[model samples]
Target: MHYDGVDYDAGMVIGAELKNGKVSTQIGFSVQTFIVYNPANGKMELMFIIKNGQVFLRTIFIDKGTIEELLIGSVIQSKNYQAGNTGFKIDGETGIAEFNRLVINKDFKIIGDASKIVLDNTGLAVYSTSGGVIKLSRRP
Candidate 1:
């Protein structure tokens, strides 16, 4: 998590895994904004969360190529994540990676042991335990 080759501003990482469990990274962006950037590629992963009078941002940045690759891979793996009412969703705008397909699920988990699941459309597969199904053919 580096931006422009500099250490990521710790405050901008929300819901980021840390020494004290899944704590929200704290950055002062309108008291409700934080941005994540992956140094490897130079793209931006942005996320925002507000809880108990506090707002946090969760995002990641890397090169477009990397993001694209990730998206494609996500599409393929999405299928594996589906299970007994659990599903996922993938928007075309997400990327051309394997997992660009949208997924959907019900009664899913987001933290702890059930964080993310990987699937393989070509080789390996993965996915998340969240709700919804992978939604493709509707994105730009």
Candidate 2:
């Protein structure tokens, strides 16, 4: 992963596969964090997580996602800040991306698999046989 900002630029790539004979399968993925901007406590200005320049894991905080706690990131990104609502409770800690929309299973591994599943990039809902729809934000 690599990052470039006003202060500095950095990136790294570790090419190695996870190996284990103890378990039949293992789960793995690459994680990267950027200091591009700051959100409030329990939040951070989300840059995005993209794989292969197609999908975009968004970082925008919904207004209803906790107005007070979200305003900080908004301000950092030159958005309006409603400082009066500072009493609003924060939802969770920083570095926590909303993965609730992702779908994974024994057969459909999110990482370390070569299977080609339907990935909807047009912000349209794509449903699996089990009827769970994946609705991701459009590419940035």
* TM-score list, all predictions: 0.16, 0.15
- Best candidate, lDDT: 1
Model 2 C-alpha lDDT per residue in residues 59-129, reported as the tens digit of each score: 55556553444334421311332222111122233422222223357785554221222323344443454
Best model number under TM-score: 1
lDDT score, candidate 2, position 96: 22
lDDT of 1 at 92: 48
lDDT of 1 by residue, 15-73 (tens): 44466665555534443333344555565544555655765556534355533333243
Off by over 4 Å in 1: 1-30, 45-140
lDDT scores in order: 0.42, 0.39
- Where does the lowest 10-residue lDDT sum fall in candidate 2? 81-90
